[model samples]
Target: MKKIKNNFICKIIEKDILKNKHIKIRTRFPPEPNGHLHIGHAKSIFINFNIAKIYNGKCNLRFDDTNPYKENIKYINIIKKDIIWLGFKWNKKIKYSSNYFNTFYKYAMLLIKKGLAYVDSLNKFEIKKYRGNLKKKGTNSPFRNRSILENINLFKKMKIGKFQEGDVCLRAKINMSSKIILMRDPVLYRIIKKKSHHQTKKKWCIYPTYDFSHCISDYIEKITHSICTIEFQENKKLYNWILKNINIKKKPKQYEFSRLNIENSLLSKRKIKILIKKKIIKNWSDPRLLTISGLRKRGYTPSSIRKFCYNIGITKKENLIQMSYLEHFIRNDLDKKVNRAMAILNPIKIIIYNLPKNYKKIISIPNHPKIKKFGKQNIILRREIYIEKNDFEEKNKKNKKKLFINGKVKLRYSYIIKAKKIKKDRLNKIKTIYCKYYNKKQSKKIKNNIIIHWISKKESIKANFEMYENLFTTKHPEKKKNMLQYINKNSIIIKHGLVQKDIFSKILKKYIQFERIGYFFLKKNKIKNITFTCITKLKK
Candidate 1:
């Protein structure tokens, strides 16, 4: 373990395995294939994968696919893509809990032969009622004293589909009066007559409980340390109980850390699934949803996501991270990467009459202002150019800098120009403005007027830009009584715009800086032409 940046888990490895060079360090990231991977999962991926990389160990990508009803093949593929996209390479074969079903069944039988586990006929609700809360101790079930031979027959029957759902459950026969409720004879297996599993299809009707399978899966895979979030801390007692009764010497020890909690967003998979079902959001990949696919579609880079996780690090304490803290890292990552271009949203035309007819002048501007080697793009200076409509005000003011009657505004990377005339039609809207360009000698006299970005009216391509905000109105949206009450009504706003024709194409995934505007990403929609999504603002 590296002491310079040692996390709590690494310290455990140092004490447990470092002294004995024979035991190699190994870890695994096991995610249930139920939903799209979220940013919270990204933290776990970084911790598991990077720790292995740092210690010259191995990290396995294992899917804890215990629930066949909720798990989908599509979700598994998306998860695989997401992990690879985040720059973590796992074993090509991959691992699944369902793959160890036969072994898990045998382990259960071993516990039964030792009179440590048995088949119980109690329904789930009755069992939950008997398993009292923190204030009280639980009562043992009537079926807890069943003979080992009877339990073996019942278990085999459950596995062979002889039992229906809710009929019976196989449970670990631990002390019912234990302080932790999970140790009160927790269910080891349940009967579910489902036919199409992603990996194992219709071979068995019984599935192992997460509590029973998680620890054993790690043991079967020969993992050194089993790491998970703090919510599973209480379940650790149950985790160790299963491994202990089996008397496995070369097994893994579980470790827990705080999970990621971001303000104004909910990370619960079940809650997110509710939103999807209610049509509150478009889908899992909606730009405001914050899932891995959503973030990728909204133009967040993989490197930025990885950096955000690193900066947060691993802490024993749980804290709600401000959304702006994450925004800061992405803004910094994109600053020196994407090239700059000029785009005018809600543009108004400006005609420069000083230039002669049938004449054009080509001017150059650096792609990246700080790095000269990024090279320059050549744009032709035409008679007409497009500037934002907000740039032209009704009257000239001394404090505000815009295209006024006497205000001399510098066109970016070009000569100085002043508004000579204003034109508008119905509703008193400003449609066009006539301006006069200043020569090299006259340009030196300008002052106080701010420069603005624009694109040529004759050469620029039209585009639609979508600006996205948080999906929820409140900072803690999940706490609301009604989930719909706190939804942001206007989470998305669309506006027409014009971008420099020399660079922006109808289809491009690369990030581009739109001059005074924020960085943007071109959408991958084939039905719609030339649309951009706002990544973040560069105001900081």
Candidate 2:
């Protein structure tokens, strides 16, 4: 059995267990399926799922699909796929708030019959005016004093689509003078006519608000711990009040922890939608975005993400984590998992003068420098090859380590090569480097020679290398007045490159480290050429 770390929430659960508060524990990941889940939701998923795993409890994957106007069946499927990709399985068949629409209606009726809830006919603006701000006490609604029978009848009529949208709503009859405004008769159910719910469809015209449905769903599911981010701290009062008023015993408890906020990353679904709408990002799975789909597409492994969440842990203190902290984990993970391949991003041709024309030899290179179990890959070495343009120089400087004129450098896994001459194009750019190759025994005297990765021209394939950086230039773009100004123009830099044919080996993983370059994954796009996205730069 795995032991859970002693966080505040975990401690509370432990105390409950020791005191025999319950025989079994239940937790849930209740995401509203209006949009794809982001890294912030990854934290919540980690908490709920792992807590259930460590406690031998069951965690339900429940979609809080109360707002059918925004929610979609596609988004629900995407959410389920992401959770499964992150290596979590729901305790039972997937759950949805719509699954308990009848139960929720019954509970709402119970509230109205107990004189704890009332149907108000005030317009949205009027309702807002009556519900005052934090410093002011809200005034009672004009329809607040309606008789229980009348309120129930009005609610029934509202449910049956007799009232137009926003004309009437069901509200809890909590204190209007209470400092907590959410308790000031929060709207429970409202009229949203004609819009067909993904699940219920036109079977009903009324929909329950999140505040109303979330707690009830938790109670109906028998969730022992209604865990959520700190933004819901005040809502805990309402969550308990609804259960209490319904006269339900053994009510679930709501615990709040700080949400994950990374520097220069946007986790808000509304903001992400705006970016997509403006064509700034391709979609929810844009490699540059921090969404779970985006991260997976960018070659971030499930283990690495889970490890990152565990390292960050659950805390009530809100702090913005550095993006590099996440990069560090992926680097550590891929360093061991990823195989090595040679790719020339900026190619400069190299010709061995001493070798015969059509000279070719198949050589085996180890896939990983430290892991022999990864085995080796077969690559071709020929007379004509390509090396990184920056790997060679015409003019030799003091202590220059690259293949400069009359300077020597070792071609990795092959031979020591010394540049003899270079061919220049009309633009004065080095077109080709003419060099001589020496056997390892003959080059034994060469001291402090740098080794460079190279690929045979005939055996290499054309590829595009996509380099990615932070999407936002500033650390706290959310605080800025015009966040669009902070968008990093160079977030994605594409370059045409050449990759060794061995890169297509069957044993290769989704992501591989380009020798002398950074890590990369085969890009999944419709482009004809083989494309790879740079996961990250080599550790400095």
Q: Who wins the TM-score comparison?
A: 2
> What C-alpha lDDT do the candidate models reach, one value each?
0.84, 0.88
Residue-by-residue lDDT tens digits, candidate 2, 1-540: 344343788889999999999788999999999999999899889899999988899999999988878989999999999999999999888999999888888899999999999999898899999999998999999899899999889988987889999888999999999999899999999988858899998988888888888988888889999999999999999988988888788789899998888998888898889889989999999988889999998988898898888888788999999999999989999998878888999999999989989788888878898999998888888999999988777888777667789888888888888899988899988898999988668888777459999999998878899999999999988777788899999999998988876566722666889887888888753335788888888875
In candidate 2, stretches whose alpha carbon ends up further than 4 angstroms from where it belongs are 4-6, 393-406, 436-438, 524-528
Give each prediction's root-mean-square deviation over alpha carbons: 2.6, 2.4
Number of clashing pairs per prediction, in order: 0, 0
Best by lDDT: 2
TM-score of 2: 0.93
lDDT of 1 by residue, 1-540 (tens): 332233887777767765783266788999999999999999999999887877778999999998898899999999999999999998557999998999899999999999999999999999999999899899999999999999999998988888889999999999899998888999999987854787888887899989999999999988888889999999999988899988788768889999888888878899999999998888888888779998998999998998888888887798889888887878888887877888887888988878776657788778788978767777777889999887777678766767776567888888799888888889887878888989767887766358877788777877888888788888877677887788887888888887767665322347888878788887843323678898876773
Clashing pairs in 2: none
**Residue 247 local lDDT, model 1:** 74
